[model samples]
Target: MYVVIFRARIRQLDEDYRRSAERLRELALGRYGCLAFHALSEGEEEIALSYWPDEAAIRAWNNDPEHRQAQQLGRERWYAWHRVEVAQIERAYGAAP
Candidate 1:
């Protein structure tokens, strides 16, 4: 399994930004092979995490045209700074409460 993490310092942190972010997340979470998605914001910081079955899905999601456009918009209009991290999940253990 693969996990992707995104950390951002938001510039224009407003309703419009939230709308676009949610739309982009929906697209990603709806894509084939996506296991799950999560996002949050606090103060000027925003974070998102997504899980995928393998590297190919992550690569394809990264190269998606709409995702590319969203990333460009993040740099140009929404985010003052951003960081991304990808890692393999060797094992995960949990259960529903």
Candidate 2:
């Protein structure tokens, strides 16, 4: 498994941003082979973590037209700064309570 970490300094968020975010999450999970998606925000900062099966899926998702539009909108309106990092999972260990 691989993980994409997205960190952003938020500029502003409106209804469009909310709707777009929901749609993109659905699109990523349903069409792009996203294994899981999680996100949170605090103050003016946001972080999202999405798990993927491979680099190809990630590349495909990145190139999707709607996603591209969202990226542009993010750059123009929603985010002040953002960074994305992709990393491979080496091992897994977890506990459930």
Candidate 3:
């Protein structure tokens, strides 16, 4: 499995940002083989995590046109700073909810 982690310091997030964020999540899951996604925000910082089957799936999502546009918007409007990391998962464990 692969994981993409995004940490950002927010600048502004309006309705357009919200809509596009949701759309991007849907696209990632429905078309890009994204296994799961989670996000949290506190104060002006946000962290988003997305899991994928492999690096190729992650790469495909990263290069998606809509995603590219969103990234550009984030850099120009919604975020003051951001960092992204991709990692391969060796193992994972969790208890049932």
| Number of clashing pairs per prediction, in order | 0, 0, 0
For residues 1-97, write the lDDT of model 1, one tens digit per residue: 9999999998886676678777777777787567898888899999989999999999998898878888888899999999999999997888942
- How far is each candidate from the true structure, as Cα RMSD in Å? 1.6, 1.1, 1.0
Best by TM-score: 2
Per-prediction TM-score to the true structure, in the order listed? 0.88, 0.97, 0.96
Clashing pairs in 2: none
lDDT of each: 0.86, 0.98, 0.95
* lDDT tens readout by residue for model 3, 20-93: 99999999999999999999999999999999998889889999999999999999999999999999999788
Residue 51, model 3, lDDT: 92
Which order, best to worst by lDDT? 2, 3, 1
What tens-digit string does per-residue lDDT give for candidate 2 at 1-97? 9999999999999999999999999999999999999999999999999999999999999999999999999999999999999999999887942
Give the residue spans of candidate 1 off by over 4 A.
none
Clash pairs detected, candidate 3 = none
Query: Which portions of model 2 show Cα errors greater than 4 Å?
Result: none
- Report the error of model 1 at residue 53, Å: 0.5
Q: What's the lDDT of the predicted structure labeled candidate 1?
A: 0.86
